[model samples]
Target: MKKISRRDFLAASAAVGAAGVLTACGGSSSTAASTAGSAAASSAAGGKSTDYPTKGISVICPWSAGGGTDSCLRAFCEAMGKNLGVTLTVDNQTGGGGILGHQAIADANTDGYTIGMITFELATYKKLGTSELTWENYAPLCRVNTDAAAITVGAKWAADNGITDLPGFIDYCKAHPGEVQMGGSSNASVWHIAGGYLMSATGIDIQMITYQEGAATAVQNAAGGFIQGVTVSLAEARSFIESGDLICLGVMDEERNPVFPDVPTCKEQGYDITYYTQRGMAAPLGVDDAIMTRLEEACAAAIEDPDFVTFMNNNGQAISYLDAQGYADYLKQAAVDVAAAMDAVGL
Candidate 1:
């Protein structure tokens, strides 16, 4: 097996440009075939006045299993299972930073048996002009939660560079603008967005590098002196922080994250911006509305379940529940907002 490093993965991201690659796959004819027999069987099961899920439910995770997105969905599924009365099985269709899996679920039958998790890529890839998969192509079900990014410096780098905290780091950058090198996966990725937003706000000139490797690659490179700082979600870098490999500099949220109470937010640091990337459930365009509604309700129930709440809280996730309609509205506004930002940054 190839033990791919994050640097190796992200090198390609910078080279090719991070773009959205998704499409609506399942239509009535295709989905009808996939769902007919199961629907019939389920209907018969319900004829006896039994509950839903006379069949198994498939939740497609567009990212690799065991990654941040997958782990979060797993927690939600465990809670949703109780309300859905079915075995919510997760199918990992990993590729193209989640497009393969996104397409898989998007094309699945909308007969209330198939659902999938949606992430930032749902809007970003499309903006990159890579694919036709846009928010318009998917039925927004429910947003599970929103994650605020954390700007971190590799511990050794911080020590070697003599930067102790957020204020100190800013002073260092001001003293040596453009001398500090920053690395991220690609344009429109969370890292890129965070780096760009911070740079714009601070008026600091940093050599931002983009690689295709992904967040893991960014973390490794930052630790190895390949870059000076990284703007990624705390969850992705949790392990390194625990090992004292990285120091949390600032968060891109309204306030400090409970898990890292000591860390100040961008607002507190005097940068006025909130970069909450909400991850959630979505289906391919043209999926049945009733099924979308059902999935939305299921996710809502899961978000409130104590077990799921505790699990996410333990993992440092913030609860920002949005039902199907609310999710749709958010996506619409996000598209507009991000487009404006990208244009302003000349990305």
Candidate 2:
């Protein structure tokens, strides 16, 4: 399959605001949800900034304990707790493909005592029809990190196919469209969308095998040769790559990930594609402005905490910071972009 020329990809990205676009079916998330915006604003209006965090606070996590999101959030919360002078408890409210926990965060009291780590999947909830939850449902505090997806395959498969690099792999896919199989984290997950992005960028056809259990299983399938490769992040595929069982062909990022300096970016290999899954903190809608400000400050301070910094570096997660307003703007644009990706995968 002929990969997309840089000019073609840039034009496509431009049509969708670089991030991409959701069809009008997902509605205009360009602005914060009116109800949430007005309610949060009115809640703060006529009120003096008050002292926050007189007691312990809880943080909701949509994923399972010990997972990437959970561990990172735990470290972050610990740092934030230090800044706020209060304990921050992480409640793993896992279920419904992160919908239940995300909804729980939005439905929490507006007292700023309850906040949560919202993830990349928040952009898909409404489009997937799983829940009405979206970034518009919460008052964003700040963006924490983003992990870029990668093209990693079993060493045996690459050797057998003579796929020495990303171009070689693309040539094989072009020669035998629909014969290649790639694994993904879950249906409609970011890894899944990465597959669609790959196909959209390269004009190739391949079967996407999805594992609902998550990326760990998909990574295993790739290593075991049950699939041709995986489109998950390098961190998720790190063990296999390290063991020489799998070789990463390319990362969908503008620059190389520091953890894996040798892995070339897709852009460097003639594809201008870049995609990542993000995580950030947010509170329920209608949180008082003063409390939101205090929480945002805690998030800013906590992101740079030495412990959190070490934890993220060691964990292979990249820190991509964005303040409250920037995060809100990003969420809106991400919703637009994700809609187009969902369309790409026939979601």
| Candidate lDDT (C-alpha), each | 0.63, 0.73
Listed in order, each prediction's TM-score against the native is 0.79, 0.80
Angstrom error at residue 81, model 2:
2.4
> What ranges in model 2 sit over 4 Å off?
1-51, 65-67, 340-345
| lDDT for each residue of candidate 1 in 1-347, tens digit (9 for 90 to 100) | 01212222222232211221111111001111111122312222213432345776778876554345666777888787766666677776755655676677778776767778876665666667766676777788877777776778888889987887777888888888667776644445556555665665566656666544345566667767667767777766677787888888888777888888888887787766556556778776765544445566667788898988998888887777878788888878776765555554444
List where candidate 1 sits over 4 angstroms from the true fold: 1-51, 211-213
- lDDT value for model 1: 0.63
Score candidate 2 by TM-score against the native: 0.80
- For residue 286, model 2's alpha carbon misses the true position, in angstroms, by 2.8
Clash tally, candidates in order: 17, 2
Predicted candidate 2 versus true structure: per-residue lDDT over 1-347, tens digit per residue: 12112222222322222453210001000111001011111113236656577777888877665345666677888888777777788787766666777888999998888898898778888888988888889899998988777899999999997888999999999899778888765556676666767877787777777654456667777889988898877777777889999999999888898888899999999988887778889999898777888888888988998988987887677888899999899889888877775554456
